[model samples]
Target: MDKEDLKKLVQKIISNHQIGVLSSVENSKPHVRYMTFFMKDFILYTPTKKNTEKIEEIKNNPHVAALLGYVEKGSNDEYVEVTGICSISEDKDLKEEFWNDSFHNWFNGADDPNYVLMEIKPEAARILNSEHMKTMEITL
Candidate 1:
């Protein structure tokens, strides 16, 4: 597929999937956790708590990676590997845009001080699928 097609495929995968594994580094070791993500084009956003370990990890090491769109029982399972730099933000508009009741388990509401947004600006990505057992790079 061409770059444009790859971009569309990546966007479609992200749009179809809400949960992804976000990988970060801490104390020279790697840590990964499943997170609910909101994506706008190639940029991804995930809400997190201020006191979470991932917050500190991102603070120390801004580089991060994520895996999205995988299904255990599917033969044609396709996934995207996104590598990017993460930056934390407390933008109210963004918070309101991505907030949902499910997050209440972690924060009081959209205005909760503990709630923050982790923005991943993808520098590069690779879309993998079972069809050719190959990966295609999506140009950012």
Candidate 2:
């Protein structure tokens, strides 16, 4: 696939998916966990608590990776893998923007001081399918 097709593929997967695996370097090893994400203009955001271990790991190392677009039982094997540079953000407007009713389970509110967003700017991305022969990548 060409760059434009790859971009469209990325948009289709990420825009349709919300849950993904986010990884950060911890003690020279990869530390990964499930996170709810938001995408806009190809940028990724994952809301998290400021004091979480992932925050410290990201602070010590800004590079991260994420996997999105997979579902149970491998029914939908197609997915997007992203390697990106991550930074922490506490912008109130963003907090408000990313907030949703479901977040109430983990946060007191969007204004909660512990709440923060991890902004990930993709350096590289690829779409893969375990059940298909299709795969493509692009650098940004």
Candidate 3:
């Protein structure tokens, strides 16, 4: 696919997916975990607590890889593999934007001091589809 078309497909896949695997280097090894994600202008954000282990890991190694949009549709499903620089955000507006009542399970609320947003600014990405088996690099 052309760059524009590949971008559309990547955006479509990301927009339809919310949960994914985010990996960070910890102790010189890769640590992967499921995370809930939202994106704005191709920048991914995941809500987390300031005290979480992942926060420290990201701090030590800003490089991260996230797998999004594989929702159990077998070989037909398309997913985006994103490699990005991760940073922690404590901005009030962003916190409110990503806030949800269900988050009370992990946080007191959006206003909680421990609540934070993990922002992933993609340096590069690839659209992976089983049927197509095409790996298209995207410059974000």
**CA lDDT, every model vs. true structure:** 0.89, 0.89, 0.88
| Least well predicted 10-residue stretch by lDDT in candidate 1 | 130-139
Q: Across residues 42-119, which tens digit of lDDT does each residue of candidate 1 receive? A: 789999999999989998999999999997776688988899999998999999999999999999999999999999
> Which pairs of residues collide in candidate 2?
none
Those runs of model 2 whose alpha carbons end farther than 4 Å from true positions after fitting are 130-132
Candidate 3 Cα deviation (angstroms), residue 61: 0.8
Candidate 3 to truth, TM = 0.92
lDDT of 2 by residue, 1-140 (tens): 67877877787888788899998999999998999988877889999988989999988999999999978666657899999999999989988999998998889999999999999999999888735566777999
Better of 1 and 3 by TM-score: 1
lDDT of 1: 0.89
lDDT of 2: 0.89
Model 3, 28-105: lDDT tens per residue?
Answer: 999999999988877899999899899999989999999998788557788889999999999999999889898999
The candidate that achieves the highest TM-score relative to the unseen native structure: 1
Q: Which parts of model 1 are misplaced by more than 4 Å?
A: 130-132
Worst 10 residues of 2 by lDDT: 128-137
